[model samples]
Target: MIQASISAVPGLIVSFLILAALVAAPTALVAKARSKPWPLRTALAVYLVGIAAVTLLPGDAGLESWQCDTGMPTRLFTSVSSLLNIALFAPGALLAVFLFRRPVTVAAAFGALSGALELAQSAGHLGRSCSVTDLAANATGALLGSSAGALWIYLRRQSPGKPLRDLAWGMSLGALAVLAVGGVFESRIDRVDIVARDDQKRALAETAVQADEWITAAARGVFGSDTQVRQTATATASVTEPDEGGCRLRITATTNHGTISGSWPAKTLESARSSDVRADEGSLGAREVAAAAARLAREWFPQHAAGSVQRVRPVGHGPTTVYRVTYRRYAHGVLMPMRLDLTLTGTGRVLGFAAETVADPVLPPVTVDEAEAKALAQGAAGAPGEFRRALLLARQVRGVWRPVWLVGDGSGGRASGRDVAVDAVTGERIAGEISGAATPTAATGGPPSSR
Candidate 1:
């Protein structure tokens, strides 16, 4: 998590400097007019600009609607990122106290500022998630900074500037103002409530042992045997409702170098990032990335490496290019449920890995042909388009995994394209969740033939 945060610092620094330059001259003039220390006021302005740059300006405006995260951390200071959030607002609060001469007022003002910024992050389409945990951390930092400022004033025998009655009035008004703003914005944002679950009815020791085994394997594969891997948290199990009959146990473990997380029993590597594979300073071509990823996939899954269809696509354009590689296996021209997906940087550093592991499912006979599936899809969609590709894959229907024909125009593959799944046995349209299994397309084959 710390490494992920560190990777973003360069962009944050550039944005902060640009915002600071725009505000510097006006900030200095205001400080001089107020007879306060110009340097301290300038610092305060720059610090606020840093906050804006970090939260509001850095990310792309891709969000379609406002979102609010109502989940709270299980514990405070849960990670390095949470600690950094606390530190982010402390300096601003400290500076405000010295400039405004009222510690309580400064803290309240900072609290309001944090709330307003969070609202902006959500409603302004900044592609940032607003969380209650962050708001709590920012408020805590403001209080701590204000307390330190109050202590300094006491030690110096300086007047605190406001009487008790006036201080109470100021705090009450600030609270009311904050409440008003929050009430206005609450109805506009969508609240996302996250619930944590553990449904694996097993002994704690057993779960820990299983998690340790997987974590050890992943760490050794990504880093080496010598790296010190530690279980960051207890493994948790959640019920998976797919046709695949097993619950998923998610294990998160951190090495001294990086973090690795995956599911148990299935023995799949969900994601792992280490400092071992440093990102390349320059961009790499798509072919280079695909070749590197293919090599790694072959090395990791030697048993299922042959006769798999590989697809490589580049995501995000910048100084670095991250490639998304997917390998889909097939049996006798029918797409298998098993799949391997990898996300790698231009330097071939593996940022993510997800492999779907499933035993060979007993498939029903294919009764509906590709042409029938296309006609059914055309009827369902109520519009006509050139249907070029038809692929055979498995989909879940009424709690059973069945062979289904995916017929589409070959636009975005099976996942996002104008595809329709028709149950091969019953010739009925499959309408719900596609399947837990990954779907393969006609990218590696010729025109569809009768099954």
Candidate 2:
């Protein structure tokens, strides 16, 4: 239980703190307003907003234990989770309802707020999920809170003018109880460092996959896809050790996405650097190329997408040197995806960038309304097991899809094969044996199929 509390503590703490303020502020106003509809309505409104903020602000994806990625045969309990959500929120909502006479207004406010939270998640604007299950759960919580309030009102009406102090005590005690219960599920503090290089970014990602100890060190707990950093201090690597010149970089990321204090190290920085001061004029250098790409990319994304640009120097480049820039963009929903990659060059010049778009394969096109991209993606999964595992290991990448001309499949298999180019945003294929192979063309820089 302590372990569970520690893991989920972050979300829980934020949720409860916000909930407390919402509960106290509104209840006080509602109490002062007496039977008036406005005060209670306003409180409900604030509560809903609070819920949305708490749900979204945390970068960590709930608790590590909360997520079970067993691979293939995955079960997304939209229904069960939804039910649990209702159980979670219903009590508070019912309490609010019982405390007010305007049940209809409360219901409307609760539903609208729940819907808005879900929409934020759906749009992928918020880090949290926009789940139908959450909507249902929020609604249920609101209803239950309101109902409890209604019951209290009914009992109070029996005594007519009995001391108002009596009611105040009960409400106060109830609030305290809620707060106490919340204490059991708070998430601990976590710190994470966001690096400026793609290879570094992936190095951290790989650590999460390859070394459990590494992740435990970085996060202070079992890390998950959603481990969040409350505050980040940026430090430019003062010196890049030439010996650690592998494409992947090693960084320390600390998080508490687990039951106990788990300090873990995860590698993050990754990129290609110039082997030496080269004189290849026409061939743009990695840093210079990345900068130019970032500028172009910023111009390319949907204006509304939330993003940031980071400047990175290849280890040895000194104070006067201009390094590469990495561009990161995040959006909402199951389709709400985030893409991160390079943009600028070593000379601080513009360069091409890489991007990834994570969207539900079934969502129809906003432009041509073509076939569902998700279905097409799934069809490429090769098999059902592959389909199930794909979700767990989906890695979107950029780069022109290049065809490995006449590539041999080995094992006395000399059939021509097209190599799938995976850059930074979209690439997921289940392993399977195929009889023949097709030649792959250089990525034209569009969809996976185009590659």
Candidate 3:
């Protein structure tokens, strides 16, 4: 709070000067017809300016534009200041209605002002979201103030002395009711900085295939011999080139089961052990594949872990079809973030598998469900980083799978988003993947995964 007040000074000065310039003429005119206009209008102006400064100022950086900013996703309405943001504007609207004796005009004008402020925050890259919900809350406060002021005016006419005090008491009672209703509001997990589109992988696949620059054999062997394999490679060589930390490539195979994607560098292939067709006594299905994968990916297994099938799909066409089995970690009904995927050819040959790892010993409780975790993820998207979405997953650490929330932003490729992992239960940020424009801290650093 102290830091907030101190930082708000610069914003307050600027907001006051700008607002005064825009409203000086109207304010001057109102002063002519009103009693105590100067003091009241001045107070209203101060209130308006103060609210603006408090809400929008003290950004992470100075005078940022869209091009240069990069911010993390921020959760909204989770702090005392957020509530204060709504309350601070109420007095100004009340003062305006008192001055102009026009509740509707004051309410409508203040509502428009609130909208404009939200718009500016979004467009101006001022380190805040142009949230529709915030606008509604601001407008609601203005309306509440207008009602109070108008009621006070009415009561004054009906009973001259102590009318304002009576109105204040009534409003206090109403405010209590509003607070009671507001108690239900909770902070939601929102996924921000998402993949721009699903088609993003398509372009990379096309390019790697066109250039014939990526590994096709590993995917072919893993996804099945006859499944049609498509691959794409990208790195951070130049603005138009894929050439970052070497080059990462993705192999997508369309099989009869649906689609299976494998990613790695050609030389640094993350090799996997596959099963022989004759080894499995049971028929092919989600359950059969999951059981088989559990054995193959036993290195990732924990004494406390159990496996459930997330999906089973047949992709590709013709002579060979690969059934992709996605086996996920589970704790009771809650899905853990850790996963192991298995693909099988028509002949029941194991195609390949990939699994996630967790180095952190901390496993969060399941306090936050998927819905709330998702909301938190979206709110994590920050400046220049529009929130895309979040997913709940478990990362394997010391052979134990822990629940995690994966947050992402818009970048590109498999590793392109500003990604962060959070402890699902504790709401504490866990260092895992840092993919967007920012560099990873030492604790969160790891080899960038392909998918």
What TM-score against the true fold does each predicted structure earn? 0.45, 0.26, 0.31
lDDT of 1: 0.70
Sliding window of 10 residues with minimal summed lDDT for model 1: 194-203
Per-residue lDDT tens digits of candidate 1, residues 226-321? Answer: 768865665556656455455556777888767877766656666676655545555668888888877776766554456677777777687577
Q: Candidate 2 — worst ten consecutive residues by lDDT sum?
A: 386-395
**Candidate 2 RMSD to the real structure:** 23.6
lDDT of model 2, residue 27: 62
Runs in model 3 lying further than 4 Å from the true structure: 1-36, 55-58, 61-79, 125-129, 157-451
Across 83-197, the per-residue lDDT of candidate 3 in tens digits comes to 5555766788888878777666666667767766655655575655444445556776788888888898898874323545545654664455345323322222132332222
State candidate 3's TM-score: 0.31
| Cα-based lDDT at residue 352, candidate 1 | 63
Best by lDDT: 1
Ranking by TM-score: 1, 3, 2
Off by over 4 Å in 2: 1-50, 62-80, 143-451
